[model samples]
Target: MPTVIALTRFGPPEVLRPLRIETPRPGPGQALVRIRAAGVNPVDCKLRRGDFAGTDPAGFPQRLGNEFAGTVVALGPDVPADGAVAVGADVVGSATAQAYAEVLVVDTAGLVVKPPPVPWEMAAGLPAAGQTAHTALSQLGVGPGDVLLIHAAAGGVGTIATQLACELGARVIGTAGEHNHDYLRSLGATPTTYGPGLLDRVRALAPDGVDVVLDLVGGEAVTTSLALVQDRHRIGTTVDRRAVEEHGVLRVGGRSLPALREIVGKAATGRLTLPVRTFPLREAVAAHRLVESGHVRGKVVLTV
Candidate 1:
């Protein structure tokens, strides 16, 4: 048996409890992984709090977590024994609702190689945020000379998006807390604190005007972006469904294996950085609380 954190019932972080489950065996095209680290994402918190209660059909005791990094402990019968995903290969991937466990089965196709230079913690943090940032930038067509405005730029996805935008030759203006402003600048973004005076601050930073806006924080940020950029198509968001429906700003963030692979490669060479706050697997309640706080500098992860 392996212990996994499961929702006893949807409520606060206290609702999460460790439950023992029968060790899962992989079927064809799947592999059994012994998880070393799992990323704690905001969506996991949303699910636990029943944010999507009406539309989500999952019952009680549902598992949380979408990204993980670990070692392949066993391979399915049909999986090639000598392939890149062998018995002892270290790997990382998105495993919807299943990564917060000691062991779990996942499709081999979703796994990306964890390079020697990338630590288990960083590898675990990359999948969801990396894919989301990459896809969002692609959807926005970010490129040379574009001034990209990233709201909540100190968070997991924002941290990666800031670096990727700079890599694409764009000038990134990231908004975070006063403390995180310096951190954003180190990643090649012009930093500004988000709030009442945001519009004026951004105007001063990029006097030529912002070419694109990627809003990670909803609410006022959406309205702020609307005023800065003229083309609604150039304004995108990972949050704010209401804004998408009413204002026609593009909704971003989706799975992209190629993008995940590219991100992992960059992280391996030190071209990318994703700071993580680690907690023991059994301390999942604390991890969930941290993610729900909305003030995490980088990423929060559970070490299994």
Candidate 2:
């Protein structure tokens, strides 16, 4: 039997409990991984609180966590010899609400080879935030000469996006608290304090105007982005769905294997970096509380 963290019912972080279950076997085109680390995301907390119950209701004892880094223990039937991952290979991938377990099965097509230089904690944290940031930048056509404004730039997704955009030759203007301003600068962004007169502060930095916006914080952030950038299509949100329907602003990000590999490579070569806070697997509840507090500088991970 393998242990997994699951929510016995929809509620707060306290609902999360450990359960012993039969080890899952891989199906065709899948692989069984012995998970080394799992990332704690805001979505995991939301799902636990039944935030998306109408669309993605959870069954009792439902697992949490969407991304993980681990080693392949077994390959399923018909897995290609030249596939992206192989048995005994170190890998990282996204999962469907099941990465919290000690061992789990995942489709081979979605896994990326984890480079030797990348640590387990960083690899586990990369998939969701990395892919989302990569996809968002691609959607906004962020590149050379583009001035991109990123809200919540010191957070998980924003940190990666800032570095990636800078690597792509874009000038990044990132919004964070005064405390994280210097931190954002280290990641290649011109950091600005986010709150009260945010528009004016950004204007002072980029007099020509911002070409694109990636909003990780909704409400006022989206409103501020609309005021700064004229093109609705160039403005996107990962947190605000209401703004999408109301303003026709683009909703960015989807699972991308290529993006994952690219980010992993950058991280391996020291071109990209992610600050991580780690906890043992049983402390998932405490991790959830920290994430829910909304003040973590970077990513939070569970060591399994």
Candidate 3:
């Protein structure tokens, strides 16, 4: 049996509990991994709390985790054994919703070799956030001379997006609390406090006006971006669905394999950084609660 973090019912963070289940075998083009760390994402918390529509209660004991870092233990038929999928190879990759366990199977196509220099906690945290940042920036055509605004810019996705934007020769204006402003500055973003008069503050920073906006915090953030950037197609939101429907703003964010590979390579050379807070796997409740707190500096991870 393998122990995994699962929700016995949909509710608060407390709903996440450990369950024992038979270890899953890899199918063709898949690899079995012994997870060393799993990334605890915001979506996992949302699903557990039943915040997202269309969740069925019949899916109780549902697992929650989309990214993990570990070592390959076995390969399924048709998985090439000479590469990152080989047994004993350390790897990191995305999953569906089954990563928060001691062992689980994931598609071999998703796996990237974990550079020895990257710690397990950091590697576990990369795939989802890194890919989302990469995809959103590309979709928005973020480029040189552009002034990009990223809401909630100190969290997981924002952190990655800020650095990637800078790498693309774009100037970044990142919104965070006063406390995180200095941290955002370290990432090459012009930091501004987000709240009342956000538009004025951003206008003060970029008198020429913003060229793009990536909203991680919903509500007024989208409204603020709408005011700063004239191109509706350049304004994107990862969290707000209503704003997308009502305002026609692009709903942006998703995983990309090529993006993750590039991000991992940058991380390997000490270029990208994502600070992590870790807890033992059994403390997934605490992990979820911390993420739900909405103030974590970078990312949260469960160490197995």
Q: What is the TM-score of each candidate against the true structure?
A: 0.99, 0.97, 0.97
Q: Stretches of candidate 1 above 4 Å error?
A: none
Clash-forming residue pairs, model 2: none
Tens digit per residue, CA lDDT, model 1, 143-222: 99999999999999999999999999999999999999889989999999999999999999999999999999999999
Best candidate according to TM-score: 1
User: How many backbone collisions does model 3 have?
Assistant: 0
Better of 1 and 2 by TM-score: 1
lDDT of 3 by residue, 162-222 (tens): 9999999999999998999899999999999999999899999999989999999999999
Error of 2 at 127 (Å): 0.5
The regions of model 2 sitting more than 4 angstroms off are: 80-84
Worst 10-residue lDDT window for candidate 1 reads 52-61
- Pitting candidate 1 against candidate 2, the one with the higher lDDT is 1
Name the runs in model 3 displaced over 4 angstroms: 53-58
After superposition of all CA atoms, the RMSD between model 2 and the true structure is 1.2
